[model samples]
Target chain A: MEKNKKNKLSIVSLVKKYLPATVALVPLTIIPAPAYAGLITIAVSSTGALNFGSLDAGGTGGTVVISPAGARTQTGSVVLLSGAGLESAGLLSISGSTGVLIDVAMTNPAFAITGPGAPMNVGGFNIDGGGSSVSLTLPTNPATFPLGATLTVAAGQTAGVYFGTYTVMANYQ
Target chain B: MKNTKKGSDIGKALLMGTALVSLSSYQAEAATGTGLMSAIILTPIDVTSTQVLHFGSMSVTTAVGTITVVPNGTGGTRNAGTGSVTEIAGAGLESEGALQITAATGLVMNVALTAGPFTVDDPGAGLPMTVDTFMGQAVPAAFPFTTSIVGPATNVIVPVGATLNVPAGQEAAVAGITPATFTGSYTVDVNYM
Candidate 1:
């Protein structure tokens, strides 16, 4: 016929080029095959600070503790201020604030601790008798303010407690 | 020329597979950057002078005499300040507050580790006990100034250039210093110069 119509138009142009390449493989196989394949995440961040350590001659309100393994970076929080003023006139205040948390304890091998209050700063005459009361009677330590709650040291008692060693500094500014 | 050389090898394999899918999508198009700052730290309780317990302002004479203090040494450096102008030992008088000995040039100095050796009696006396509190620190207690103590190391720190040469006649020994368990305290401003 024209040669049989050129072989049926080359078999209808190879079925229209394989029917759009088999319809692009049916969207790569029914499209219901995504299986969520692109995403992953995890996060953590905590800027740091807590450098507390200083209670020399801790006689007025007496307290000292800071251990969390002595800390360098425990994830932060311990501000305690008031450092310059020891020419010897006496005006050192550390009752609270500077990153407050005045007394939080537990140490001896166990860590994470604190207790820094009572550096009350006084000295016009409360010398040892603490007569007008400035806090000094430490026997067996009921918090130690011993002058005579019947703590008994009789004889001629004048002044005692000779312990000294300060500078408990800490920081992760 | 051969179908344009087979369409330039399929456009060079689609630009190398679109750069291998954009370098494997670099961990899903990742991007992160951060920074922060603020500082000022210091914790110092360095009341340095090393060690001192000197005295000598001139009007010294209360009674239990033996005065000679000043790094002199007998026990360690010098311990020849044995004084006594008063004798009243047994204890019973607790003033949590309201105690003052203003012009007695007071040095109720009580450093007893007692079992024995402490006495203060004079001023005719009857019940003139006068404790005002000793080691816990606070003699004048608080009148027109800051006063209160009971701290770590328990104050002996008189560092300002320190020169407490309490000489004149020196007398207020009452040091029975008992510490089987007895902490310390003081507030001696015997300024009778």
Candidate 2:
């Protein structure tokens, strides 16, 4: 019994003596770099001002509609002129480096115009050149498309220059 | 007997040293770093135009003139000749193209601009004019900019200014329409390195 106890004590002492040295070797493992690497870039610009220039709602009044697909049409008694008085759909060009599908978000999905009277709602606002909310694969480096808003008019609405601001955003998937 | 005992002691020392080294290596193999791994899957860099780049209402003289606007967001003036490049007082943020960039951090990016030779046509008249020059500057005027991922936001402001070169007599020849603005847009890309 005495001999066995002595041996056990020696083994404990040996363990204590070498424990610190064992701990010192912990920092030498090799590490490698991450497997994937790349970055993406995106840009946007209004190809031209979204101008609903000089419109005559006539004496009765009418609605001027511009579609996101670059179509312009009028309802009611509105008459659009062509002699230097041009009305055009707003064009926004989206550029992306990833060449992948991206999400587009818009602030103030609706806008309004006012002139010497109560504000008029310019509803049916669209920015994706299609539906209101859509994700699209960047077709080109700088893909140019139309963003449109429809001006709703009340009968006998006042005529003057009206203005407002809206914003469009893009993000990667 | 004495020499043999000394040899045995040396052998025991060597064995203990070897055992210590082997145990230490095993402990090291089980140990892990405490510094933590930090990473971010960067979102695509996005740029939005808050303001359009415009020289603002310019009038040209019979003489060929060049309008140069500095990139400091200052309005430009026509070179001495016949035309006038008056800074439209309080013309808003039209003199320089104001834009905002949003993305992740730790990125070294390259900025490239593709511009110039943009054409604007007179409606129905068929006489189209050309804007021969356009230029831009990145904010802080540094290439390969580095940014932080942890902050209130990870975004930068890049203000770009442009110069429009009108030939000798192209101003008055433009279509006679009020607010008959000319359009010229340049493509700017932020490439990652």
Candidate 3:
């Protein structure tokens, strides 16, 4: 019996000495594996309308030009009637992956301006720089893009209000 | 009993040593890597007009004068008091041009107007009068989008005013019957900024 007791005591001492190492082994199975993959996304929004406020149609009539930079000029019978909301270039908000390229295109090159008088043609649409398609390098954050347009005013283009529609497309590159 | 306990201790130590070695092997095999993917989406933008701008009809006089039509009221100097700017009643939302825009929530937008003055010519007399200085007022006071939170659409009302300069002794549209119509097209551009 005394021998058996001595043997049991030695075994217990061995377990106590190894208990710390067994506990330390638990962490090896519990540590989380690291993730190595990620994804990127992009989006866009609008700010306001492009305004070409007011112009005087001289007896002969003429054309009004709005530069992509929002500069205004008049020709022929068309006189730039001075007033507020007179002229402003269109603005757009582009956002997405930082340091990425984006392509912009206009679906319609020309549209009609219809109002009280006969329908008038509004052509020569330009965005940012002069061209049908333009490319931009998107910033890491959201940014603004300016668009300008020009219209062909006809002789005796009646007197009244006019409206038209156009489309702009953007693609991630 | 002593033999049984001794045997069990040996078994336990061997089992623990095997587990420790297995754990070491797994730690050595631990490996990692990384990858990347990209995506994007867009929504359409739109604006619908609710009201048409109108500067009421006025009578032309032989004497030189001007007619000014502002949002609050329409009044300019009329020689002989015969020529005046009158207000025209209309159906629906009054005050000028009203527009509704649709786009992504919280998106910012810019409103731009470009057009010149209007002109009226007398068919019988072959003379023209000019309506110059076109001005516009937005209901919110500013042309920027305050919020797209309510929905994808925002409403805006714009009231337009203009000035008319009539040359001295300008002929009327008719002998004493009709008022010549003066009309022209204006362009409004809206976009995301």
Higher-DockQ candidate of 1 and 2: 1
- Ranked by TM-score, top first: 3, 2, 1
Candidate 1's DockQ is 0.03
Q: Backbone clashes in each candidate structure, one number apiece? A: 84, 2, 44
Interface RMSD of each: 15.2, 19.4, 15.5
Give me the displacement of residue B177 in model 2, in angstroms. Answer: 61
- State which docking tier applies to candidate 3: incorrect
- Residue B39's lDDT within candidate 2 is 10
Question: lDDT value for candidate 3?
Answer: 0.52
Tell me which of candidates 2 and 3 scores higher on TM-score.
3
TM-score of each: 0.23, 0.36, 0.37
> What TM-score would chain B receive for each of the candidates shown?
0.20, 0.57, 0.50
* Candidate 2 or 1, higher TM-score: 2
Q: Each prediction's Cα lDDT score?
A: 0.23, 0.53, 0.52
